[model samples]
Target chain A: MVDDEADLAEAIGKALRREGYAVDVVHTASEALEITVYTPYDLISLDLTLPDGDGRTICRTIRAEHEHQPRILMLTARDDIEERVAGLDDGADDYLVKPFALPELFARVRTLLRRDADVAIGAELEIAGLRLDTAAHRVVWKEAEIDLTAKEFSLLRFFMTNADDVHSQEQLLEHVWDAAADPFTNTVRVTVGTLRRKLTAATGLQWIETVIGAGYRFVKEPVPG
Target chain B: MGRIRLPSFAETIRFRLSLAFAVVVFAVGAAAIAGVFLYENSTLVEPVIMAEKKIVRDLATGELTEVSVIFPEESQRVMAEKVELDAYRRALNSLRTSSFLALGILFLAAFGSGWFLSGWALKPVRSMTAVAQGITGSDLGRRIGMTGPRDEMRDMGDTFDSMLDRLEVAFDDQRRFVAEASHELRNPLAVARTNLELALQGGDDEEIRTAAAIAYDAATRMSGMVDELLDQARESLPVNASETVDLGDLARSVVQDFRASARQRGLRLEVRADPVEVTGDRLALRRAAVNLVSNAIRLAPEHSTVTVSVAKAEDGRAQLAVEDVGPGLTPDQRTRVFDRFWQGEGQEGRGAGLGLAIVKRIAERHGGTAEVVPAGDGSRFVITI
Candidate 1:
């Protein structure tokens, strides 16, 4: 992890280390660049603005130097979606905005790491009192197993995978259902409504948030009923 | 005791200009009146006075000896002419006073006309002053719509209005940024707080691990947000990094980075760039290019190809274009695509919809432009420097 904030770096380091990932922490951009240059880390949690240089630059330098570049998860105070997209463009595998829930961070890291199938093929996605097993395609919410249709499960996975970020119905349809734009389809909304009802019934936690004229925003940490 | 009315002499452009006009009028009017008075005195009065004296001298010796005191031809004539000369002298004195009076009237007229003309010519300037004075950070809508014959005063007003236009645009971008920043800042902090609390109130190791992992993510996000905010703070300054950046190399490097993600999404990110160099900030240019690519990737379909090309335009401007064959943008979307936080239908959660805005800013900073060039399949984002 590359961060200037001591307490935040320590806390995040401790949390990720518990997930069986060997993590290293750096306080300055220089140290980050130095460590990244030498060590082949699995992932680098970078702060965009650093004491020495910009995190985006560091991300670029890493991508330039390393043949097998480690996945980069950008952490920044920039909450703009364009900044996030730009971060990804700058070689960051994922991005999270400031003061975000640890659960959301976990989800992002897990998603990035999961991209490397060799390392994380069947890792479980855990959101307080809720767990998703990718290999078994099973969900246990509040210690109770809930039946889900394949489409519903796919939709839930997408929402869970990208927790705390809003996703439009079109985007949801594109990612979850591999079909191109069919302007007449309301399948995404119907599926989401069913998933929200089922999840709420079982876990007693409301997780899906609808943004008007936008799309659905999934809660990083489940909201208690 | 009465209230004292104090004069306010300010260095305002309007006051200075009006004073200048009044002074010029006074100088020209005074000179004209003085010339007329001097010419009239020399031509009409001086010769007449001299001839009258000569006649008096002639009468004093020869004609006076043979004169009858009763008839008194030479003496009476000389005396009457003397009274007439006195009258002429009084008339001359009156002319001199009248010239002074005319000068005094001219001074007042010059000053009044100068003040009136300056005010009339500077109506736009006064409006500009009001706008400049009344404008604050929040209110950027004031304008000096000067309409008149094309003159310097009108030009200044137009220039001032254009300047305000630029300012309003810049402020609009920053203002929207601040609003979005506030809303976004809360989410990550809330995320971190909740996860930390969950970790603190954990019952099982799995719960603690999940909570801690999430908390870590949030902290990372928060620090990154701070970084982004700092970057925006520094964005007001022009890009001072002057380097020989090879546009082709920059495009290639970006393409190489996104190669994996493109493949993962079953989309192709192709770079057809020629070796081109432009003097600019590398980081900024790279970001501009990256925003284009990222936007294309987001909007493009799974099987569609996203092309990022760098070449020289006909005008010798180094150009970068990112084209994607996806659901094409409508006229409305194209218009507002660069507006801050403008997420068109189904465009939310895409980095606050600021990709195009940043690209435009970066392009502008490089003394260039970013716009959409109509493409065959979908939309093409073009940045020319």
Candidate 2:
């Protein structure tokens, strides 16, 4: 989130973090740009007016520069049609006028994430014998429901979407974790290990395989009986 | 739409102008023709008929005698005089007829051309009327934009266009003021709502306390904004200008009011008075002075001096100025510093942002001007009436 109002930005960041989405907050366009250069965010809630620069220009520059496109949700005090149209035309994915409900913002964020994941809103993802409902945030191994933490759930969702493909620890860190995460940490491995153990305990099958000198990949199918 | 009802011919400017033109042309043409005729008549000399010498063969002397014979029945002088009078009468009659004919032609030509020329000349006025009638408060952007050589009609059009320009600007300012007011209110409202919502979410004691604190701050900001808005409205109201206000006294009172606050902030309040007086609202002028002094105290550096000066300028305008040893306004900021709700660079939520605007309003209400005087390393705000 980028807003000149530091208090509002902090409040929104705390709320999003409570919802299990890693969030980073900044107060100026320059700071936002400087940070986005290193860590690619999943979605950015940008305030239209900023002290250093316009949010639309920043959105446009992010779209032009980043290979991994981040969804831009513009937050503007102006509810006029022209402001919204200009923001969207300048590469904003959506806009929420100021003084909006927190619940509505959360819902829009969820929808944007689902869109980014290439899944329908509130749709259930089923691969082989594993089933996960994104809206309910539930996971079922075979017929047994498995409980998971927010991070584990996020990791599982990421692995399921890109099943059979290898993702390095850095890639997972960049995608699942926010810019605040330390790059040198083993949080990704630890979370992935925990997720694997949880899935194996439920179905008694090893669902994740680690290729030596490479990275982790989710098994697309259960082992043949 | 129904056609406009035309005024009577006599009531129309074109008709009156044409009639006036015809009258003038007739008068001048008749006088010129009559003068030439009179001059010709005055120069007409009666012809002299002299007695004729007749060589008559007398009955007795055949070829010797030549006699002057005058007829008794016909007087040669009278006959000559009658012929001359007849010729003069004919010439005068022709002259009179041609003169009248020429005068009539001149009057008709003058009236016709006058009617056409008047209509052509009034075309701009017609367009100006059309433009004026078509304009409304919401549609103030239309301008005559009349392009022509400088004339009375063009000057009127230009004046009208300039007036419209000013009106459009004022209207736009009003709209923007309302929008900014709403936006200002909404920002704090949003902050308060978010903070209260978070506080209600059953966070830890410290987190809840922080949320409540932020919410309280937002509420304070909203109240401040409301109060400032009220102050602005009050300042815009017509001041009771029946009383005389001494600027020196007003500045001293303002200085006294802000002295404690300045001392508390580790600042000095200095005063220079010259006993300048003006006829205006005393309360309004005091408010203006108080605003300037308070602003200077707020912005001036600690341990620096804020000088409140009241004097008559060189042109004999009564003036009150507050000079602060603070971060001076830049050229860009100077232009907009007096604008309503104009925030200083990165100084959001510091104040209600209407102080300068109110001061400006008060200054203008007294038929005066407010300005920021350039300083080497500080700022000075002056109100002169």
Model 2, stretches more than 4 Å misplaced? A66-68, A123-136, A140-144, A160-165, A203-207, A218-225, B1-169, B238-242, B346-349
In the range B163-225, model 1's lDDT, one tens digit per residue, is 889999989877677867775566556556745755684437886787677767766765756
Candidate 1 chain B: minimum summed lDDT over ten consecutive residues — where? B46-55
Q: In model 1, which runs have C-alpha deviations exceeding 4 angstroms?
A: A1-225, B1-80, B94-124, B146-159, B198-209, B225-244, B248-280, B288-385
The whole-model lDDT of each prediction reads: 0.75, 0.83
Model 1 lDDT per residue over A1-225, tens place: 887655567667766645434467787888988877655566788987665678999999899876658889888767777778889998888888777766677777767766753223356766665777664668887667889887787677667666788988766765565323364689888989999999999888888999999999988777766
Estimate, for each residue in B1-385, the C-alpha lDDT of model 2 and write its tens digit: 9978667777888799889988998898888887888788887776654567887887785766678766754476668778888888897998798778888899999999999998999899999999999999879978999997999999999999999999999888777777778777777777777777766777888988898889899889989889888888777678866697788987887788787888898998999999998998888788788878877887777899989898888999988989987779988889999988777767634666788989999889888999997776998899989
State how far residue B324 of model 2 sits from its true place (Å).
Answer: 1.6
Candidate 1: Cα lDDT at A162: 67
Pairs with steric clashes in candidate 2: none
> Across residues A1-225, which tens digit of lDDT does each residue of candidate 2 receive?
998887888898888777777788899999988888777777899998787788999999998987767889998787767789999999999999878888888888877776744333366667776888766778976677899999998888778766788988888897788877999988998999998888888887888988787889888775632
